[model samples]
Target: MNTPTFRNWQSVQSEVLRRIHAREWPPGELIPNEADLAIEFGCARSTVNRALRSLAESGLLDRRRKAGTRVAAQPVAKATIDIAVIRHEVEEHGAKYGYQLITRRIAVPPVSVSGTMKTRAQDKLLHVRALHLADDAAYAVEDRWINTAIVPDAAAEPFDVLSANEWLIEHAPYTHGDISFSAVQADQGDAEVLGVAPLSALFAIDRVTWDNAAAVTKVRLLFLPGYKLRTQL
Candidate 1:
Protein backbone atom coordinates (compact mmCIF):
# COMPACT_ATOMS: atom_id res chain seq x y z
CA MET A 1 0.00 0.00 0.00
CA ASN A 2 1.21 3.54 -0.76
CA THR A 3 2.13 5.47 2.39
CA PRO A 4 -0.53 8.02 3.31
CA THR A 5 0.81 11.56 3.33
CA PHE A 6 -0.88 14.48 5.11
CA ARG A 7 -0.38 18.04 3.85
CA ASN A 8 -1.55 20.06 6.83
CA TRP A 9 -2.31 19.88 10.52
CA GLN A 10 -6.02 19.51 9.82
CA SER A 11 -5.50 16.43 7.66
CA VAL A 12 -3.26 14.93 10.34
CA GLN A 13 -5.89 15.76 12.90
CA SER A 14 -8.58 14.11 10.84
CA GLU A 15 -6.51 10.97 10.46
CA VAL A 16 -5.78 10.88 14.16
CA LEU A 17 -9.46 11.37 14.90
CA ARG A 18 -10.29 8.56 12.52
CA ARG A 19 -7.84 6.27 14.31
CA ILE A 20 -9.37 7.18 17.66
CA HIS A 21 -12.94 6.68 16.51
CA ALA A 22 -12.06 3.42 14.77
CA ARG A 23 -10.34 2.16 17.91
CA GLU A 24 -7.03 1.85 16.10
CA TRP A 25 -5.81 3.84 19.09
CA PRO A 26 -8.09 2.60 21.82
CA PRO A 27 -9.02 4.37 25.04
CA GLY A 28 -6.29 4.83 27.63
CA GLU A 29 -3.72 3.72 25.11
CA LEU A 30 -0.50 5.65 24.82
CA ILE A 31 -0.16 6.91 21.28
CA PRO A 32 3.13 7.22 19.44
CA ASN A 33 5.23 10.29 20.18
CA GLU A 34 5.12 13.29 17.85
CA ALA A 35 8.38 12.42 16.09
CA ASP A 36 7.04 8.96 15.35
CA LEU A 37 3.65 10.36 14.21
CA ALA A 38 5.41 12.84 11.96
CA ILE A 39 7.42 10.09 10.27
CA GLU A 40 4.36 7.93 9.87
CA PHE A 41 2.18 10.69 8.46
CA GLY A 42 4.90 11.92 6.11
CA CYS A 43 4.61 15.41 7.57
CA ALA A 44 6.72 17.76 9.64
CA ARG A 45 6.92 17.19 13.38
CA SER A 46 5.24 20.56 14.01
CA THR A 47 2.21 19.46 12.03
CA VAL A 48 1.77 16.42 14.25
CA ASN A 49 2.33 18.58 17.32
CA ARG A 50 -0.34 21.00 16.19
CA ALA A 51 -2.78 18.17 15.51
CA LEU A 52 -2.11 16.63 18.94
CA ARG A 53 -2.48 19.99 20.66
CA SER A 54 -5.86 20.50 19.04
CA LEU A 55 -7.04 17.10 20.25
CA ALA A 56 -5.71 17.81 23.74
CA GLU A 57 -7.69 21.04 23.85
CA SER A 58 -10.85 19.16 22.92
CA GLY A 59 -10.30 16.61 25.75
CA LEU A 60 -9.68 13.77 23.32
CA LEU A 61 -5.99 13.28 23.98
CA ASP A 62 -3.89 13.86 27.08
CA ARG A 63 -0.38 15.21 26.58
CA ARG A 64 2.15 15.63 29.35
CA ARG A 65 5.40 17.47 29.03
CA LYS A 66 7.60 14.41 29.57
CA ALA A 67 4.94 11.71 29.55
CA GLY A 68 3.88 10.36 26.19
CA THR A 69 0.49 11.45 24.84
CA ARG A 70 -2.35 9.05 25.48
CA VAL A 71 -5.94 8.70 24.41
CA ALA A 72 -8.31 9.81 27.13
CA ALA A 73 -10.00 6.88 28.81
CA GLN A 74 -13.04 9.06 29.18
CA PRO A 75 -13.20 12.10 26.96
CA VAL A 76 -15.25 14.94 28.30
CA ALA A 77 -17.63 16.54 25.81
CA LYS A 78 -17.45 20.30 26.15
CA ALA A 79 -19.83 22.88 24.78
CA THR A 80 -17.93 26.02 23.88
CA ILE A 81 -19.68 29.37 24.01
CA ASP A 82 -17.87 32.06 22.09
CA ILE A 83 -18.06 35.61 23.29
CA ALA A 84 -20.56 37.30 20.99
CA VAL A 85 -21.01 40.89 19.90
CA ILE A 86 -24.51 41.70 21.12
CA ARG A 87 -25.15 44.25 18.38
CA HIS A 88 -24.36 41.64 15.73
CA GLU A 89 -26.35 39.01 17.61
CA VAL A 90 -29.48 41.23 17.77
CA GLU A 91 -29.18 42.42 14.19
CA GLU A 92 -28.82 38.83 13.04
CA HIS A 93 -32.22 38.16 14.59
CA GLY A 94 -33.74 41.07 12.58
CA ALA A 95 -34.19 43.43 15.56
CA LYS A 96 -32.65 46.84 15.81
CA TYR A 97 -30.08 46.90 18.58
CA GLY A 98 -29.76 49.74 21.05
CA TYR A 99 -27.68 50.33 24.16
CA GLN A 100 -28.06 52.58 27.17
CA LEU A 101 -25.39 53.09 29.77
CA ILE A 102 -27.05 53.20 33.17
CA THR A 103 -24.05 53.61 35.47
CA ARG A 104 -20.29 53.98 35.26
CA ARG A 105 -18.18 54.41 38.36
CA ILE A 106 -14.96 53.38 39.98
CA ALA A 107 -15.79 51.79 43.30
CA VAL A 108 -15.15 48.91 45.63
CA PRO A 109 -17.18 45.91 44.63
CA PRO A 110 -18.86 43.45 46.97
CA VAL A 111 -16.67 41.16 49.07
CA SER A 112 -17.74 38.12 47.05
CA VAL A 113 -16.78 39.83 43.83
CA SER A 114 -13.42 40.92 45.22
CA GLY A 115 -12.74 37.37 46.41
CA THR A 116 -13.55 35.86 43.04
CA MET A 117 -11.63 38.56 41.17
CA LYS A 118 -8.62 38.09 43.47
CA THR A 119 -8.54 41.77 44.29
CA ARG A 120 -8.22 43.31 47.72
CA ALA A 121 -11.40 44.70 49.28
CA GLN A 122 -10.01 48.20 49.12
CA ASP A 123 -9.09 47.90 45.46
CA LYS A 124 -11.47 50.04 43.49
CA LEU A 125 -12.69 48.56 40.21
CA LEU A 126 -14.50 50.08 37.28
CA HIS A 127 -18.17 49.19 37.51
CA VAL A 128 -20.46 49.74 34.54
CA ARG A 129 -24.13 48.92 34.15
CA ALA A 130 -25.95 48.94 30.84
CA LEU A 131 -29.15 47.85 29.19
CA HIS A 132 -29.44 46.17 25.77
CA LEU A 133 -32.59 46.82 23.79
CA ALA A 134 -34.20 44.89 20.96
CA ASP A 135 -36.58 47.03 18.94
CA ASP A 136 -36.54 49.47 21.88
CA ALA A 137 -37.72 46.69 24.20
CA ALA A 138 -35.41 45.53 26.94
CA TYR A 139 -33.32 42.47 26.08
CA ALA A 140 -30.77 42.12 28.84
CA VAL A 141 -29.27 44.06 31.73
CA GLU A 142 -25.49 43.89 31.98
CA ASP A 143 -23.74 44.60 35.26
CA ARG A 144 -19.99 44.43 35.00
CA TRP A 145 -16.76 45.22 36.83
CA ILE A 146 -13.48 45.72 35.05
CA ASN A 147 -10.02 45.52 36.56
CA THR A 148 -8.43 48.75 35.48
CA ALA A 149 -5.10 47.54 36.77
CA ILE A 150 -5.09 44.87 34.11
CA VAL A 151 -6.83 46.90 31.41
CA PRO A 152 -5.92 50.54 32.03
CA ASP A 153 -7.65 51.68 28.86
CA ALA A 154 -11.04 50.78 30.35
CA ALA A 155 -10.68 53.44 33.03
CA ALA A 156 -11.05 56.18 30.45
CA GLU A 157 -13.92 54.50 28.61
CA PRO A 158 -17.35 55.82 29.60
CA PHE A 159 -19.19 52.74 28.25
CA ASP A 160 -21.76 55.08 26.68
CA VAL A 161 -21.26 54.38 22.98
CA LEU A 162 -20.06 50.84 23.72
CA SER A 163 -20.96 48.26 26.34
CA ALA A 164 -18.38 46.83 28.69
CA ASN A 165 -19.31 43.36 27.47
CA GLU A 166 -18.27 44.29 23.94
CA TRP A 167 -15.43 46.51 25.04
CA LEU A 168 -13.48 44.02 27.13
CA ILE A 169 -13.84 41.37 24.47
CA GLU A 170 -12.11 43.58 21.98
CA HIS A 171 -9.44 44.93 24.33
CA ALA A 172 -8.55 42.38 26.98
CA PRO A 173 -8.60 38.94 25.43
CA TYR A 174 -8.81 36.40 28.22
CA THR A 175 -6.90 33.10 28.28
CA HIS A 176 -9.66 31.33 30.18
CA GLY A 177 -12.74 32.04 32.28
CA ASP A 178 -15.63 30.59 34.21
CA ILE A 179 -19.26 30.78 33.19
CA SER A 180 -22.52 29.71 34.79
CA PHE A 181 -26.07 29.70 33.50
CA SER A 182 -29.06 29.76 35.79
CA ALA A 183 -32.67 30.76 36.05
CA VAL A 184 -32.61 33.69 38.42
CA GLN A 185 -35.45 35.74 39.88
CA ALA A 186 -34.89 39.34 38.89
CA ASP A 187 -33.74 41.61 41.67
CA GLN A 188 -35.21 45.12 41.88
CA GLY A 189 -32.23 46.67 40.12
CA ASP A 190 -32.17 44.20 37.30
CA ALA A 191 -35.94 44.14 37.05
CA GLU A 192 -36.10 47.88 36.65
CA VAL A 193 -33.39 47.85 34.02
CA LEU A 194 -34.87 44.93 32.10
CA GLY A 195 -38.38 46.31 32.52
CA VAL A 196 -39.66 43.09 34.03
CA ALA A 197 -41.56 42.41 37.23
CA PRO A 198 -39.36 42.05 40.25
CA LEU A 199 -38.86 38.34 40.91
CA SER A 200 -39.71 37.33 37.38
CA ALA A 201 -37.69 34.35 36.18
CA LEU A 202 -34.87 35.36 33.88
CA PHE A 203 -32.06 33.57 32.14
CA ALA A 204 -28.79 34.76 33.62
CA ILE A 205 -25.17 34.17 32.77
CA ASP A 206 -22.45 35.06 35.25
CA ARG A 207 -18.95 35.10 33.83
CA VAL A 208 -15.49 36.02 35.07
CA THR A 209 -12.56 36.17 32.68
CA TRP A 210 -8.84 36.57 33.21
CA ASP A 211 -5.91 37.57 31.06
CA ASN A 212 -3.35 35.04 32.21
CA ALA A 213 -3.25 35.10 36.03
CA ALA A 214 -4.50 38.68 36.31
CA ALA A 215 -8.26 39.22 36.45
CA VAL A 216 -9.78 41.17 33.56
CA THR A 217 -13.52 41.45 34.10
CA LYS A 218 -16.51 39.96 35.86
CA VAL A 219 -19.97 40.37 34.42
CA ARG A 220 -23.53 39.27 34.92
CA LEU A 221 -26.11 39.46 32.15
CA LEU A 222 -29.76 38.95 32.99
CA PHE A 223 -31.96 38.42 29.96
CA LEU A 224 -35.67 39.06 29.85
CA PRO A 225 -38.11 36.17 29.97
CA GLY A 226 -38.06 33.72 27.05
CA TYR A 227 -34.34 34.00 26.37
CA LYS A 228 -33.03 30.79 24.84
CA LEU A 229 -29.42 29.68 24.70
CA ARG A 230 -28.23 26.97 22.37
CA THR A 231 -24.87 25.22 22.34
CA GLN A 232 -23.36 22.03 21.01
CA LEU A 233 -21.34 19.38 22.77
Candidate 2:
Protein backbone atom coordinates (compact mmCIF):
# COMPACT_ATOMS: atom_id res chain seq x y z
CA MET A 1 0.00 0.00 0.00
CA ASN A 2 1.22 3.53 -0.84
CA THR A 3 0.21 6.89 0.59
CA PRO A 4 -1.41 9.20 -1.96
CA THR A 5 0.02 12.61 -2.83
CA PHE A 6 -2.47 15.44 -2.87
CA ARG A 7 -1.98 18.67 -4.86
CA ASN A 8 -4.92 20.76 -3.70
CA TRP A 9 -6.76 21.52 -0.50
CA GLN A 10 -9.92 19.84 -1.80
CA SER A 11 -8.15 16.54 -2.54
CA VAL A 12 -6.51 16.58 0.88
CA GLN A 13 -9.90 17.26 2.45
CA SER A 14 -11.41 14.35 0.54
CA GLU A 15 -8.85 11.87 1.82
CA VAL A 16 -9.30 13.04 5.40
CA LEU A 17 -13.08 12.76 5.01
CA ARG A 18 -12.69 9.20 3.74
CA ARG A 19 -10.53 8.25 6.71
CA ILE A 20 -13.08 9.70 9.12
CA HIS A 21 -15.94 7.86 7.40
CA ALA A 22 -13.95 4.60 7.51
CA ARG A 23 -13.43 5.09 11.26
CA GLU A 24 -9.68 5.27 10.85
CA TRP A 25 -10.13 8.54 12.70
CA PRO A 26 -12.89 7.53 15.04
CA PRO A 27 -15.10 9.96 16.90
CA GLY A 28 -13.22 11.90 19.61
CA GLU A 29 -9.87 10.66 18.21
CA LEU A 30 -7.26 13.36 17.86
CA ILE A 31 -5.90 13.53 14.32
CA PRO A 32 -2.34 14.24 13.29
CA ASN A 33 -1.15 17.82 13.26
CA GLU A 34 -0.94 19.77 10.01
CA ALA A 35 2.83 19.26 9.77
CA ASP A 36 2.48 15.50 10.03
CA LEU A 37 -0.43 15.41 7.59
CA ALA A 38 1.52 17.56 5.11
CA ILE A 39 4.50 15.19 5.26
CA GLU A 40 2.35 12.07 4.87
CA PHE A 41 0.25 13.52 2.04
CA GLY A 42 3.23 15.14 0.27
CA CYS A 43 1.44 18.49 0.43
CA ALA A 44 2.02 21.89 2.01
CA ARG A 45 1.05 22.48 5.62
CA SER A 46 -1.29 25.28 4.48
CA THR A 47 -3.15 22.75 2.35
CA VAL A 48 -3.69 20.50 5.35
CA ASN A 49 -4.75 23.46 7.46
CA ARG A 50 -7.28 24.49 4.87
CA ALA A 51 -8.70 20.98 4.71
CA LEU A 52 -9.05 20.69 8.49
CA ARG A 53 -10.56 24.16 8.84
CA SER A 54 -13.15 23.30 6.22
CA LEU A 55 -14.07 20.17 8.14
CA ALA A 56 -14.23 22.06 11.41
CA GLU A 57 -16.67 24.57 9.95
CA SER A 58 -18.91 21.75 8.74
CA GLY A 59 -19.00 20.22 12.28
CA LEU A 60 -17.08 17.13 11.19
CA LEU A 61 -13.95 18.18 13.08
CA ASP A 62 -13.33 20.01 16.35
CA ARG A 63 -10.47 22.51 16.31
CA ARG A 64 -9.52 24.39 19.43
CA ARG A 65 -6.70 26.73 20.19
CA LYS A 66 -3.78 24.85 21.84
CA ALA A 67 -5.89 21.68 21.56
CA GLY A 68 -5.09 19.56 18.53
CA THR A 69 -7.89 18.81 16.04
CA ARG A 70 -10.14 15.81 16.58
CA VAL A 71 -13.16 14.30 14.90
CA ALA A 72 -16.37 15.73 16.34
CA ALA A 73 -17.75 13.46 19.05
CA GLN A 74 -21.24 14.35 17.89
CA PRO A 75 -21.40 15.71 14.38
CA VAL A 76 -24.24 17.81 13.14
CA ALA A 77 -25.09 18.83 9.59
CA LYS A 78 -26.53 22.31 9.21
CA ALA A 79 -28.89 23.33 6.47
CA THR A 80 -27.84 26.39 4.50
CA ILE A 81 -30.50 29.00 3.78
CA ASP A 82 -30.17 32.09 1.66
CA ILE A 83 -31.92 35.37 2.39
CA ALA A 84 -32.89 36.61 -1.05
CA VAL A 85 -34.60 39.76 -2.16
CA ILE A 86 -38.38 39.26 -2.38
CA ARG A 87 -38.18 40.53 -5.93
CA HIS A 88 -35.72 37.82 -6.87
CA GLU A 89 -37.87 35.20 -5.22
CA VAL A 90 -40.93 36.14 -7.27
CA GLU A 91 -38.94 36.54 -10.48
CA GLU A 92 -37.43 33.10 -10.04
CA HIS A 93 -40.94 31.68 -9.82
CA GLY A 94 -41.61 33.04 -13.35
CA ALA A 95 -43.83 35.86 -12.11
CA LYS A 96 -43.43 39.59 -12.28
CA TYR A 97 -42.41 40.99 -8.91
CA GLY A 98 -44.17 43.84 -7.12
CA TYR A 99 -43.74 45.51 -3.76
CA GLN A 100 -46.11 47.63 -1.71
CA LEU A 101 -45.09 49.40 1.45
CA ILE A 102 -47.99 49.12 3.80
CA THR A 103 -46.64 51.06 6.75
CA ARG A 104 -43.39 52.41 8.22
CA ARG A 105 -43.06 54.08 11.57
CA ILE A 106 -41.03 54.29 14.73
CA ALA A 107 -42.67 52.49 17.61
CA VAL A 108 -41.87 50.47 20.68
CA PRO A 109 -41.61 46.78 19.84
CA PRO A 110 -43.75 44.23 21.60
CA VAL A 111 -42.33 42.54 24.66
CA SER A 112 -41.90 39.38 22.65
CA VAL A 113 -39.62 41.09 20.19
CA SER A 114 -37.77 43.18 22.77
CA GLY A 115 -37.10 40.15 24.92
CA THR A 116 -35.82 38.10 22.02
CA MET A 117 -33.69 40.86 20.52
CA LYS A 118 -32.44 41.87 23.99
CA THR A 119 -33.35 45.47 23.42
CA ARG A 120 -34.74 47.68 26.14
CA ALA A 121 -38.53 47.69 26.44
CA GLN A 122 -38.53 51.47 26.30
CA ASP A 123 -36.41 51.50 23.17
CA LYS A 124 -38.08 52.45 19.94
CA LEU A 125 -37.61 50.36 16.81
CA LEU A 126 -38.41 51.01 13.20
CA HIS A 127 -41.44 48.95 12.36
CA VAL A 128 -42.00 48.16 8.70
CA ARG A 129 -44.88 46.34 7.11
CA ALA A 130 -44.82 45.48 3.43
CA LEU A 131 -46.45 43.17 0.96
CA HIS A 132 -44.56 41.22 -1.70
CA LEU A 133 -46.43 40.26 -4.83
CA ALA A 134 -45.91 37.59 -7.45
CA ASP A 135 -47.43 38.91 -10.68
CA ASP A 136 -50.39 40.79 -9.23
CA ALA A 137 -51.19 38.37 -6.43
CA ALA A 138 -49.93 38.62 -2.89
CA TYR A 139 -46.92 36.40 -2.12
CA ALA A 140 -45.85 37.29 1.41
CA VAL A 141 -46.40 39.88 4.11
CA GLU A 142 -43.33 41.17 5.92
CA ASP A 143 -43.60 42.40 9.50
CA ARG A 144 -40.26 43.65 10.74
CA TRP A 145 -38.62 45.57 13.57
CA ILE A 146 -35.30 47.24 12.93
CA ASN A 147 -33.01 48.21 15.80
CA THR A 148 -31.99 51.72 15.02
CA ALA A 149 -29.46 51.67 17.83
CA ILE A 150 -27.52 49.17 15.75
CA VAL A 151 -28.61 50.19 12.26
CA PRO A 152 -29.35 53.88 12.53
CA ASP A 153 -29.67 54.48 8.82
CA ALA A 154 -32.79 52.37 8.68
CA ALA A 155 -34.70 55.05 10.56
CA ALA A 156 -34.36 57.63 7.80
CA GLU A 157 -34.73 55.58 4.64
CA PRO A 158 -38.16 55.68 2.99
CA PHE A 159 -38.92 52.01 2.32
CA ASP A 160 -41.64 52.97 -0.16
CA VAL A 161 -39.33 52.26 -3.12
CA LEU A 162 -37.11 49.43 -1.85
CA SER A 163 -38.34 47.05 0.81
CA ALA A 164 -36.60 47.04 4.18
CA ASN A 165 -36.00 43.34 3.58
CA GLU A 166 -33.85 44.13 0.56
CA TRP A 167 -32.40 47.31 1.99
CA LEU A 168 -31.07 45.81 5.20
CA ILE A 169 -29.64 42.82 3.34
CA GLU A 170 -27.61 45.20 1.21
CA HIS A 171 -26.58 47.82 3.77
CA ALA A 172 -26.52 46.20 7.20
CA PRO A 173 -24.38 43.09 7.48
CA TYR A 174 -24.66 40.81 10.49
CA THR A 175 -22.36 38.29 12.13
CA HIS A 176 -24.92 35.51 12.56
CA GLY A 177 -28.65 34.84 12.50
CA ASP A 178 -31.30 32.29 13.41
CA ILE A 179 -34.42 31.35 11.46
CA SER A 180 -37.43 29.19 12.18
CA PHE A 181 -40.33 28.06 10.00
CA SER A 182 -43.85 27.11 10.90
CA ALA A 183 -47.42 26.94 9.75
CA VAL A 184 -49.48 29.76 11.23
CA GLN A 185 -53.10 30.71 11.00
CA ALA A 186 -53.67 34.17 9.58
CA ASP A 187 -55.15 36.89 11.73
CA GLN A 188 -57.00 40.01 10.61
CA GLY A 189 -53.75 41.81 9.73
CA ASP A 190 -52.40 38.88 7.76
CA ALA A 191 -55.77 38.34 6.12
CA GLU A 192 -55.90 41.92 4.89
CA VAL A 193 -52.28 41.96 3.67
CA LEU A 194 -52.23 38.54 1.99
CA GLY A 195 -55.82 38.78 0.73
CA VAL A 196 -56.61 35.48 2.44
CA ALA A 197 -59.49 34.58 4.68
CA PRO A 198 -58.92 34.91 8.39
CA LEU A 199 -57.48 31.80 10.02
CA SER A 200 -56.09 30.54 6.71
CA ALA A 201 -52.97 28.42 7.13
CA LEU A 202 -49.83 30.17 5.93
CA PHE A 203 -46.16 29.33 5.98
CA ALA A 204 -44.24 31.62 8.28
CA ILE A 205 -40.58 32.36 8.78
CA ASP A 206 -39.28 34.18 11.85
CA ARG A 207 -35.74 35.47 11.73
CA VAL A 208 -33.44 37.37 14.05
CA THR A 209 -29.96 38.67 13.35
CA TRP A 210 -27.14 40.21 15.34
CA ASP A 211 -23.97 42.10 14.63
CA ASN A 212 -21.54 40.82 17.22
CA ALA A 213 -23.29 41.61 20.53
CA ALA A 214 -25.86 44.11 19.26
CA ALA A 215 -29.10 42.92 17.75
CA VAL A 216 -29.85 44.26 14.29
CA THR A 217 -33.33 43.15 13.33
CA LYS A 218 -36.22 40.78 13.98
CA VAL A 219 -38.67 39.91 11.25
CA ARG A 220 -41.66 37.69 10.64
CA LEU A 221 -42.63 36.81 7.10
CA LEU A 222 -46.01 35.21 6.46
CA PHE A 223 -46.17 33.69 3.03
CA LEU A 224 -49.30 32.92 1.04
CA PRO A 225 -50.87 29.49 1.26
CA GLY A 226 -49.08 26.58 -0.42
CA TYR A 227 -45.66 28.23 -0.15
CA LYS A 228 -42.83 25.71 -0.13
CA LEU A 229 -39.36 26.40 1.23
CA ARG A 230 -36.26 24.67 -0.15
CA THR A 231 -32.82 24.42 1.38
CA GLN A 232 -29.58 22.44 1.05
CA LEU A 233 -27.48 20.75 3.73
lDDT of 2 by residue, 114-145 (tens): 99999999999999999999989999999999
Candidate 1 residues lying further than 4 Å off, grouped into runs, are 1-76
TM-score of 2: 0.74
Backbone clash total, candidate 2: 0
How far off is residue 58 in model 2, in Å?
A: 2.9
Candidate that scores best on TM-score? 2
Cα lDDT for residue 6, candidate 2: 97
Error of 2 at 86 (Å): 2.2
Candidate 1 residue lDDT tens string, 116-161: 9999999999999899999999998888999999999999898898
Best by lDDT: 2
> What C-alpha lDDT do the candidate models reach, one value each?
0.91, 0.92
Report the poorest 10 consecutive residues by lDDT, candidate 2: 77-86
